[model samples]
Target: MPHLLPDTGPQRTLAASNFTYTVGSGLFLTAGVLYFTQAVHLPAAQVGLGLGIAGFFSLAVGIAVGRLADTRGARGVYATTLVIQALATACFIGADSFWPFVLAVCTATAAKAAGLAARSPLIRHYGGDRPQEFRGYLRAVTNVGISLGALLAGWIVQVGTLTAYQLLIIGNAIAFAASAAILVLLPPVEPEPAVDSPRWIALRDRPYLVLTVLDGVMAIQFKVLTVAIPLWIVEATTAPPWLISGTMLLNTVLVIALQVRAGRNVDSPVAGAGAYRRSGMAFLLSCALVSLSAGTPAWAAGTLLLTAVLIHTIGELWHSAAGFEVSFGLAPKHATGQYLGVFGLGAGLAEALGPALLISACITWGRPGWYVVGALFAVTGLAAPLAVRWAQRRQQAGKGHTASRQPPRRICQTSPP
Candidate 1:
C-alpha cells in the first residue's frame, strides 16, 4: 500500500488558521501594553480595576459571540469581527481620556471574543472529527504569533516613544486586515444544523464541565508564570530582564516544534483521555519546579527560574492540547461554537482572577506562595485522570441505555462510546 499522506485540504486550512492566530496575537501584544500605559496615569488600584472591567466584558461578550457563530457561518463572523477589531485597535492609537480608553478596550474586547469564538469552531469544522491535531497546530501557530508580538513590542518599548507604540498598534491593525483577507481566500464553511439545539446545554455536560473547571484552575498557574513570575524574578533575584525574555522565548520555540508531534495520533476518546492524564502530570511537575524557586540562592535563582519556566511551558503545551482535544471532542457538532464559548469562560475567569489571586497568595503566604500554587497544580493534575475515566464511563453508560431502548432492526451503528 502507498504511504498515506495527510489531506491537502486540511493542511491548507491549518495554514489559514496559523495566519489568523498570528494576527490576533500580534494585535493583542501591541494593544495590551499601550492600554496599560494609558491606565498607569490613574491610581494603581484603579488601573487594575479598569483591566478587570475589560476582562469581564470580554468574557460576557465572548459567550454571546460563540452562540452567534453557531447560528452564522464561522468564516463570515470571523471576517466581520476582525475588521471591527482592527478599527478598535486604530481607535486606541488616538485615545486620550479614561472614557475613551474604556470604550476602546470594550470594543477591542468584544471583537476579540467574537474572533475567538469563530476561530475555535472553524478549526473544528476544518479538522472534521479529529480536532486535537488541528487545535495543536493552531496553538503552535498562536505561540509563534505571541513570540513575534512580544519581540516587536519589546523593541517598540525600548525605542521609547509613544509614536513607536502607536506604530506597533498600526502594524497590528494591518496584520488583522491581512489575516481577514487570508481567511476570505479560503473555502467557505457550511453551517451546522441548529435544529432543536438546547441553549447553553454544554454547561450541563458533567464531564465537560469538570474539564472546564480543571482548565480554569490550571489557568491560574499559567497566569502566574507569565505575569507574576516575572515580577517575582525582578524583585527577589538578581536576574536581568534578558533572562526572563529568554525563558519565554524558549517556551514559544518548544511549543512550535513539539505541539504537532504531541497532538498526532490523538483522534479518539481513549487517546484524548491519555493526553489529559499526561497533561495533568506535566502540570504537577511544572508546579513543583516553579515552587522550588524559593530555595535557590539569589544569584542562582534566575537560572533555576528559567529552568522551571521551561518545564512549566512544556506542561502548558500538553495541557492546552489535551484540553482542546477533549472539549472539542465532547461538544455537539451543531453547537460547537457555543460549547467552546462556554468552555472558554473558565479561562476568561482565570485570566481575570489569576493576577490578583497570585499576588494575594504571595502576600499572605510569603515565600511559601510558590508551594501553595504547586500543591494546587498537583491536585488538579491528579484529578485529570480520574475525570477522564469518569467521562468515559458516563459516555459508555449513556450509550448502553440508548441502545437498550432502540429496536434491534432500528439500531444504528455509531462511533464507540
Candidate 2:
C-alpha cells in the first residue's frame, strides 16, 4: 500500500478523477466488444477500421489540442474533453448500427487522445512541488482503481446480459461526466503570456524527439509480454499455460509494489536518463531469461519465465518513472502541452505497431528473435543517456545558457515531478 495518499487538494482531486474514470474504463474494456457485436451488430472488420481511423485521427490532432490547452488553460479544455468523452460514450446507447458505432468510436477516441495529451501537463501544472512524487502515488492509485474496476466488470461478465453490458457502457459515460465535474473544481492554470515558441518547436528539438522514440521502444515490453510471451509459453516453452497467469500476476504485484520506489531520486534529467539506461539493462536481462525458458524443462522454464516477468516489470516501472522526469524536464515550460502531445506520439505508434513487430521478431526468428529484441532494447536504452545530454545541451543553447550566463530554467519555476 502507499505510505500515504496524495496530501494536496489538487492531488486528491486528480487521483479521485483518475480512479473513477479508470473504473468505467475497466468495465468497458471487459465488455465493450460484446456490446458492439451482439447488441449493435457491428462487424469486427468495421470495428477495427473505426478504431484505426480514430487512432490516426487522435495522433494527428493531439498537438493541436495540446496547443489549445497551453494557449488557454488545460483546466477548461481538459474538462471539455471529459464532457465530450461522456457524450460520446453515452452516444453508444443510440449506436445500434455500423455508421453510428463508427462515429461513436471516433469521437470517444479523439476525446481520449486529447485528454491524454493534456493529462501530464495538467498534473505538472496543478500538482505543487514534488509533482513527480505525487505522480508516483497517482500511478499506484490508477492501478488499484483499474484492478477493482476490472474485478467488478468480471462480475458483470458473469451476468452475460444486455442490460449488464448497457450498464457498463452508461457507467463509463457517467464516470467521465463525474470526472469532468471534479476537474472543473480545479483552479485554472495560467497561460504563458507571449510565449513566442512556434507550434513546431517540439519537432525542431530533435534530441527530445529521439528520447521520445526510445521511450516508445522501451514501452514495447508491454506488448511483448501480453502478445508474445503467451504464444512463447504455448508454442516454444515447456511451461504450461498456467505459467502465463503466474507471470502476469507477478508483473502486476511487482509494479504495484515497486513503481513508486523505482521513481525515487530521478527528478533531474540526468538521473532520469540513467534510470532509463538501467531499465534497458533490466529489459535485456528479462529477455535473456525469457529466451532461456524456451528449451528448458517445465519446472525450469516456469522459473525462468517468472524471473523474466519480474525483471520486465522492474524495467517497466523505472521506464515510467524516468519518462515523467525527462518528458517534463526536456519540455519548454511555455509549450509543455504541445511538447507532451508530441511526446505521446511515440507511445501511440508503438502501441499500434508493437504486436506486428514483436510477432515478426519473436515468433518468426524463433529463439533468435528474443535475442534480437534484447539487442534492440539494449541499443535503445544505451542511447537514452546520450539523447538526454543532447537535449540538455540543446535547451542550454536555445536559452543561451553559457558559463557566465543565466541557468536554463527560471529561478521561480516550479520543480518538475
Candidate 3:
C-alpha cells in the first residue's frame, strides 16, 4: 500500500525536519535535569523547581507565537524558533548558578513553545488533504529518530565524564541548527490573509477550551511511564530495575509500529472521539494492572508490570490519533494557527505539571492513586465526544448565520409579449 504522504516533496521535507529536530531534543531531554544537578552541582530541589516553573510559564507564550505564525508564515516562525532554540539549548553549558540556569531553561522552553505553535499549522497546510494521518507518520518517524538519539546519549553517559555530557549538549544544539537549515531550504509557506481584526479567537471559543482542558487531563497518562513507572517499580512493585528500560523500549517499539495504523481510521471528529474513548479504556486497564502489581510475588509483579506497559502503549497510540483530529477538526479554518496554539496549551500543561500530579497520586497516595488517575482519564475521554459535538454545532451555526446575512441574488423577470 502507498504511504500517506509518499512521493510528496514538501511532506517528506516536513518529516525529515521533524526527525532531525526530535533527535536533537531526545539527546538533551533524556538527561536535562540530571546534567543540571549532577554536572553543574546545583541543588536538586532548585533545578527541579526552576525547570518546573520555566515549563509552566512557557505555556502562555504559545498563543503569542501562534499569532505570529498566523501573520508571519509558519515557515519563517518555525525557522526562527529553531535558531532561538539552538542557541538556548547550547547556553545550558554556561549556567553555573540557579539564575543563569533558570534563564537558559526558560529561553529554551519559550522557543520550544513557539516551535510547536508553528509546526502543526505548517503540517496542516502542507498535508494538503489528510492532515491527521500526515501527523501520525511524522510521530512515528520522530519516535524512531528520538530512539536513535537516546541510544547515542545513553552510550555517551556510559563514558561517565563531564566532557561527554558537554558533547551531548553541543551535539543537540548543532542538530537544531541543522534542522533550521533544512526548513530554510524548503519553499516558503505564505501566511494566511487577515480575516477581520487579528485577535485571539481561540480564547473566545468555549467548547474548544473545554475540550483542550480535557486533553490536558488525559495527557497525564504519558507521565505515568516517564515519571511514575520507574518510581512505582522500585517502591511498590517487585519488578526488577532493568524492567524499567524494557518498558520504555516496549513503548517506543509499539508507537513506531502502530501509530500510523491507529490513526488510519480517524477521518472525522466523531471517529476521533471514539479513539479517545478507546484510549481511556486502555488507560483504565493499564492502571488496574499496575495497581495489582503491589504486594504480588516477584514473578507475578513482573508479569503485571509488563502487561501494564503493553496496555499503556496501546492507549498512547489511540490518544495520539485522536489528539490530532480533535485539534484540527475543532479549529476554525481561518485561524488554525491560533487554535492549534491554544490546543498546544493542554500538552504544555501536561508536561509542566504532570510529574508533580503523578508523584502525589502514585507516591503519596499509593496504588489508589493509579485508580484515581485512571478514573480521571476515563471521565475525560467520555466527555470528549460531547465536547466535539458541541464545538461542531457552533461551527455549523456560524456558517448558517453567514449565509443568512448574505443578500439574495435577483432572478431575471420575463417580459410579457
Q: Which ten residues in a row have the lowest lDDT in candidate 2?
A: 401-410
> What ranking of all candidate models by TM-score puts the best one first?
3, 2, 1
Worst 10 residues of 1 by lDDT: 1-10
Question: Candidate 2, TM-score vs. the true structure?
Answer: 0.90
Q: List the residue pairs that clash in candidate 2.
A: 132-417
The per-prediction tally of clashing pairs is 0, 1, 0
Instruction: Give the candidate order by descending lDDT.
Output: 3, 2, 1
User: Which residue pairs in candidate 1 have backbone atoms (N, alpha carbon, C) closer than 3 angstroms, thus clashing?
Assistant: none
Candidate 1: C-alpha lDDT: 0.70
Instruction: Please list the C-alpha lDDT of all candidates, in the order they appear.
Output: 0.70, 0.81, 0.87
TM-score of each: 0.86, 0.90, 0.96
**What tens-digit string does per-residue lDDT give for candidate 1 at 1-417?**
011123657546546546555755664655565545643344445555666788888886766777778888888888888888888877876766567777887787778877887777778777765666867766776776766776777677677576676677778777777777777666767788766535776766788779778878877767766777777766655677677667767877888888777777566656666665566566556555555565567557776777777777777776777677777877767778877887787788898898888877753455677667767866776676677778778767866876787777867788998
Worst 10 residues of 3 by lDDT: 1-10
lDDT of 3 by residue, 1-417 (tens): 134344588888888888889998888778767777777889999998898888887898888888788788889988999999999989989998999999998999999888888887788888878888888998888788888888888887788588888888899999999999898767887887676533888998899999899898899888999889999999987789999999999998889888889998988899999989999999999998999999999899989999999999999998999999989988866677788889989988999889999999987899899999889898889999999999999989877987888899999999999
- The deviation in Å at residue 172 for candidate 1 is 1.7
For all predictions, the C-alpha RMSD in Å is 5.6, 6.2, 1.8
C-alpha lDDT (0 to 100) for residue 101 of candidate 1:
71
